[model samples]
Target chain A: MPLVYAGVCSHAPGITGRKHLADPGIRDAFYAAFDDMRADLEASGAETVIVIAAEHFANFFMNNMPSFAIGMADFYDGPIEDSDWLGIDKFRAPGNRELSHRLISEIMQTVDVAYAEEWLLDHGIAVPLHFLTPRFDLPVIPVNINCQGPPLTPLHRAWTLGEALRRAADAVPERLAIIGTGGISHWPATPDSGKINVDWDLDFMDRWCRNDRDALLNYDDLTVYADAGQGGFEIRTFLAVSAAAGGAQGTVHFCEPIPIFAVSCTIASYDLGLLDI
Target chain B: MSLYYVQKFLYELNRSADLQAAYVSDRRSVLDGYTLSDEEIGALVDPDIGLLYVLGVNGQILMHFAAFHQIEWHDYLQRMRDGVDEHGPVREGVYAMTGRVGTGECG
Candidate 1:
């Protein structure tokens, strides 16, 4: 059976490697985290990775959509935006078809979705990929959850999808690793700009990496996610990763306040039961 | 397998309408393609899938309870592994309810 190693990721343009190259402090943290994660990923021996995430307008437009989408491509590349901050134009990653198609067909019964044979790498993927497997050498199976608009899958649904993905991965008989990307807190709009929910955000990170769903599920009613904060959606991605990790405890690598933007720059990794890969 | 539970959940969510239509319009197609009976779809989860899916489900999420009406972890994992045989639109309009990706119809 395959093993899942998952965690929450920050999507702020300033913290992610592709968008923020000039800031020395953040750049170092980002690179160090990437190196550590890459070594861990390489050590894990997982030839395939299934990434669960929420897309920010990187590819899909307003008209065409999929609640759940799987990416099956021959090669995947990144650096979502080409800001001078990051000199590198692109990096490589692997793609798998047999697994992606199987997962898509399986997800149809629960919700409407589609299969994308091609994809343009975005920040959500780029940031994590840069750290987990910078070489982009491993084949990746991308799974998407629509977190932006109405009728979006609730946080709970996102978690379920993670499990479904795990099932899909396990059936393959291949060494597999799973990662969920998004956030814990920090809304990205001007009106609410500079707002940071330290308590709620920090609480989310603590409970999540610890695999404490009881603490997290209770927050469905928490105000930080609904009115004062827009992170409720992104938080779902974190839950998915926790779910994929099968309740494995995680260690927090770094957590610090990001200026101007309410987004927190944090990095952490979870325990996947398999031996390295 | 909790077929009855899944049936009730589907009815409540109006997903049953889709299932019914799938069943009536193309019996064999639905059976071979997308429909996985309770008996058929309950075996895929070994440890990895079970842990991931269960992580998403706390014993308390309202939908989790509601979902229990139809199938359980075992069955869901099996469906994930086997997939459906029927042909249908992979993308539909309901996904637009949430706007992460662009929304449109897929035929």
Candidate 2:
């Protein structure tokens, strides 16, 4: 199956339903974009979706956590955020055991990847899952990354892993789609820290969709981008997704800063180049 | 000092409620029982301990129990190893709807 790839957010900053949290204009735009991406995934003839994202407190604690988790549950649940932005109780998706097992073995042969038989789908996974396939009807393969810890893998490592995933998908006789979620640019801490580095963020996003792995990995001061503000350098997920997309270029959907919580509520979609790939 | 050292020292101090009282009665005995080296003891009481003691009682105790006085790190690792042997390693893949949280959040 041709791989349909995308970058989606579960909590689009202001969209989360706290009266103090919603930005009607951006929220509208996010929904519209979500619908468009869902249509795109459908058009790509995707049979299974491999979602690469992170876990909040759901599957990780202050203690032990793996750098990666492959979903093995029969179904994965989406989290509800109390507020309307994400209050929708739950979304469920079927698990693809055959493809999931194949991908895990392929990944482990090259790196120390972990297999989580029991992992609760956190907002990181749920938010995007809810947006793309709202009914939770799709069969999904969720990959968890340790985006918030020490001994944090390098950008190159994330790229290599994504490349491995690309290979894994190519090997799957069944059709597959890939979704990479988390962060456009919002610090989440210290309200004012959410300023979008428009120039840098856009630059990274541009290069990311093109699968410019070497360029991204070789960037002289990635930590500065990661530490420069609250965006937390999670833009790397996009880079990872781009690698899976076989380096397709992108077109912007929504790009603007929603400063209510001091985070830039930016959302964009890249052309997955199904025909070209 | 490393974050680990500072956290360990503060943790030990909080584990014993009578630490201050015990220190006053006989510092050597308290130090001896924990097998703390002279350097560790010196570092613990140093006025410049900085943020080591700022973790409050509970934080201190937890850190101490984790690092020095309680279960060994190898034991926990062993448990993980044993679990993997018994239940198989945590498998990774696309899951159906399963959002386990709170007490059973992490495996």
What are the per-residue Cα lDDT tens digits for candidate 2 across A1-277? 4455555443432344232444677756767877787887788777778887755435553356676668866676555222233345655678877678887887777666777766556556666666677778888888876664444556676776777787777776777777777665543322122355556656666666556767767652245335334244455566667766666676666655555433444456567665445
Give the best candidate by DockQ: 2
Q: Mind giving the per-residue lDDT tens digits that candidate 2 earns over B1-107?
A: 23334333443354345674675576555555554445445544442221122211111122223233333323322333343344332231110012110111111
Over A48-123, each residue of candidate 1 has an lDDT whose tens digit, in order, gives: 8777777664555344656777797776666544433323457767798776777667666564567788776666
lDDT accuracy of residue A4 in candidate 1: 44
- Isolated chain A: TM-score per model? 0.84, 0.86
Candidate 2 docks at the CAPRI level of: incorrect
Q: How big is the positional error of residue A191 in model 2, measured in Å on the Cα after superposition? A: 4.3
TM-score, prediction 1: 0.64
TM-score of 2: 0.66
Q: Candidate 1: deviation at residue A177, Å?
A: 1.1
